[model samples]
Target: MKLKCLVIDDDPMICDLVKHFCSKLEEIEYCLSANTGNDGLQVLSQQKFDVLLLDYHLPDMTGQSILEIRSQNIPVIMITSEKDFAALAFDYDEIVDFLVKPLHFDRFKKAINRVHHGDSNSKSILQDDNDICYIKDGNKYVKVNYNDIHFLRSEENYVAFVLHDKTILSLIPLKNVEALLPSHFKRVHRSFIVNLNKVEKTTLEEITIGSRQIPISQKYKKEFFEILNNKLL
Candidate 1:
């Protein structure tokens, strides 16, 4: 699919740089620009863009404000010099990638690739091995043992990885997360993926983890029960 991009930044050079980068990629149809948040909002209302390359600090308002006010579900790639905002950017479901400025062509390409990676066919970009997976949380990559993951819940564009003690939110779809997970993990419902090894009990409608009972949807019930039944001694 051809991508229509919007670059919203006060800096003319940054806008030009993004346009130039977009030009290099054949998938991008055109890269449009807006200098202020108000102008950007106006442009957004008139036309639908595939992805947004937004500057955190605009002349009129911050990128966070735009995210709150915008009605569309357009995926955003935040561009900023501040590292601290990394934590905040992931809080919004619209944000897919965060790029710290002094943006290199390679990193820019990576962010654009993330926008494209929303498709089911795109290869998983997460780092994983036999024992563990590196999950991107804010500015840091958290190493999580595969056995430690109890379940994963889909939160629109984000997935919440439920560990024993805490939950880590990563800017990725559950399907993508599923691809990185080990064999023990299974999709028990539309929004939930459970680690079969961590399951303590199961009923006709739900699978029990520690304290949570996740639903077993009709679509996945037969396959899930077949796997569970096979383990019965």
Candidate 2:
């Protein structure tokens, strides 16, 4: 099926350029175009899209704000001239890719291809019963099983997935890892991701996983309770 896409940019020329580039790809169908973030939100409410080409700066709202309000399943590629904002974009795991201003057609195509391939692999992994996810570590991809994981601690740029008997540090950012993990895993704290299947119990402020007791941040209290309630029910 052709991947439906939405281009949300205030500039008419940039919008046209993106549309023209996407037209060459046989698998991409430019489904909608909006000149403002509000317009984009309206379009999102009315239709379903597989990918979103979003402008970072919008008259009404930032692309990041729009993304937070939109569905998580729709992959977003930020279109911005500010290269320094790339790190900020990574914080939002739903952003699959970033495109700098005056984007090269080849580079744009490659970015879209990566998002497409990632989505395909994620779908396949979801169908499998095995509780292992393969992530890129430096130059190689390593498979880490759920049973092997004891807990996850987030560092500045990476997450340390401490295993039962070993530890594997992944170069991929923590937010990205959190987004990819199954629902069984819970983010109890800002810097910690815990697999609920591995959790032993929970107190008012902390959760026990084996011998370690991880703190549950107030920001995630609602989600933590939801998980606990679901498990109990």
Candidate 3:
């Protein structure tokens, strides 16, 4: 399958160079470019990419800074002139490889091949290799880990990812997001889907995870209890 890639660099010439290098490999069918971190985030929110070719610095934000706030499951190849950040960049599991600027085709090709083969060290086995989904947050996509999601609550046209610290709002409906989740998530209420693994305490009416309690609707309570009971030790 052809991989969709994005190149985010402040230099327009570097963007073109990445596109040119991608063309040498038939595996890349689509490539997009952005000149700044904010613009890159916007582009990523709009499309799904398999590989990201990113520079270390930009006018709006540094590449490492962006990765620190939002985690993208897409394999990232850091191409920068600086060698100082290699140790720090490797801390992010999504980072596939770090290459010094003035990129060589052989090194670039290796990064693309790793993405094509789904060889990122951060690959998640519970869901897709990229076990994270980008939630549309205003003009940008906030990457939230699937495992970090304790539960989902429906709010009319929006859905909220209830995590340990904050609740992230997304435009997607509960059912739509529910469809994307794996078997570990179950709809115990029309407005709530709880990650069964995150559930710490349970009762007939509510499920407690961490410090929060999520309600279970009477409509689905019977079936929900049946499933939860089956897994009881």
Candidate topping lDDT: 1
How much lDDT does each candidate structure score?
0.82, 0.74, 0.76
Per-residue lDDT tens digits of candidate 1, residues 172-198?
788876765667899989899999999
Q: Give the range where candidate 2 is weakest over 10 consecutive residues by summed lDDT.
A: 120-129
Question: What's the CA RMSD of model 1 in angstroms?
Answer: 9.5
Instruction: Work out the TM-score per prediction.
Output: 0.56, 0.52, 0.50
Task: Provide the lDDT at 197 for model 2.
Answer: 81
Those runs of model 1 whose alpha carbons end farther than 4 Å from true positions after fitting are 119-233
For residues 33-121, write the lDDT of model 2, one tens digit per residue: 89999889888888899889999999999988898887536888889887556545655657666777877787577567756676432
Candidate 1 vs candidate 3: the TM-score winner is 1
Top candidate on TM-score is 1
Model 2 root-mean-square deviation? 15.1
Give the range where candidate 1 is weakest over 10 consecutive residues by summed lDDT.
120-129
The collision pairs in model 3 are none
